[model samples]
Target: MAEILAFAGSNSSTSINYELVKYTASLIENHKVQTLDMARYPFPMYSADEEKQKGFSNSLIEFKGYIQQSQGLILSVNEHNGNPSGYFKNLLDWLSRLERRFLEDTTVFLMAASPGKRGGIGAMGVVQDILPRFGAEIASTFSLPSFGQVFANGEIIDQTLKEQHSEALDIFLQKLN
Candidate 1:
């Protein structure tokens, strides 16, 4: 079975993106899904001076190890002002420092969600383009727009959106096998 690591790019305790990622991960069959809450890891802002003074944090190292060990990754990004949340970006910066090509060649199922109609598309688009340069092999991508209206009771409410998500999930699962 594929060991998939799932996480949201936001550090909010009640993040919709985290809920979306958890739901998507649960749909996969015959897989061990490990979910990460970025809030649990307290990381200082990335700065060259900080790096030179304090070196890498243990949490960053541990997070990197999890990424390295996982067979696949499921990431749902939360957009903050048309960009990745500060928490997620900081983690990415730290990971890049650890390994310039950290996600290189790793299979990733990318997704995003937001309360707005655009569904965090801006952040998702940026990630889709930039992640590959850092070594992520995107297997599939999905977006849930107007998250409050489309998701209910821990599942997708709109039939059409559900179908679209299912299709994306199917593709991601195929890659896992």
Candidate 2:
């Protein structure tokens, strides 16, 4: 089984993206999947001055270590005004500072979800473009639109969405080996 790391990009306590990560992690019981709570690993705002002053924190090192140990990632990102949340973007900045290719050789099962009709497509588009800069290869992608209407009770309620999720998961798993 692949060593998979899963996390949502939002720090909100009631994050719907977190729900999406949890649900996706559940479907891959056969794999050794580790889930991270982003709220617990919050990093300071990224700035060149801060980097020069303090260097990488222990939490940042630990987070980068997790990515290094994983063969695959199941990341669900949240959108804020058509871009990824600032919190997640900050974390990525720190991770990159530690090593530009911190996610080197990792296969990512990218995901995004939103309560809006477009899901988190805008943020997903940006993420899809940037993750490769950190050495992550896109394995597959799944987006959940109108999250409240389609997902609930710890699962995807809509049949068509459920099938699409399964297919995406399958594509990701195939790349692990």
Q: Across residues 1-177, which tens digit of lDDT does each residue of candidate 2 receive? A: 789999999999889999999999999966899999888887889999999999889999999999999999999999999999999899999998899999899999999999999999999999999999999999999999999999989999999999999999999999997
Clash count for candidate 1 is 3
Write one digit per residue (lDDT tens) for candidate 1, span 69-147. Answer: 8879999999989998888888889899999999865889999999999999999998998888879889999999999
Residue 97 alpha-carbon offset, candidate 2, angstroms: 0.4
lDDT of 2 at 148: 94
Which pairs, if any, clash in model 1?
103-135, 104-135, 105-135
Worst 10 residues of 2 by lDDT: 22-31
> Which candidate leads the pack in TM-score?
2
TM-scores for all candidates: the values are 0.97, 0.98
Once model 2 is optimally superposed onto the true structure by TM-score, how far is the C-alpha of residue 23 displaced, in angstroms? 0.5
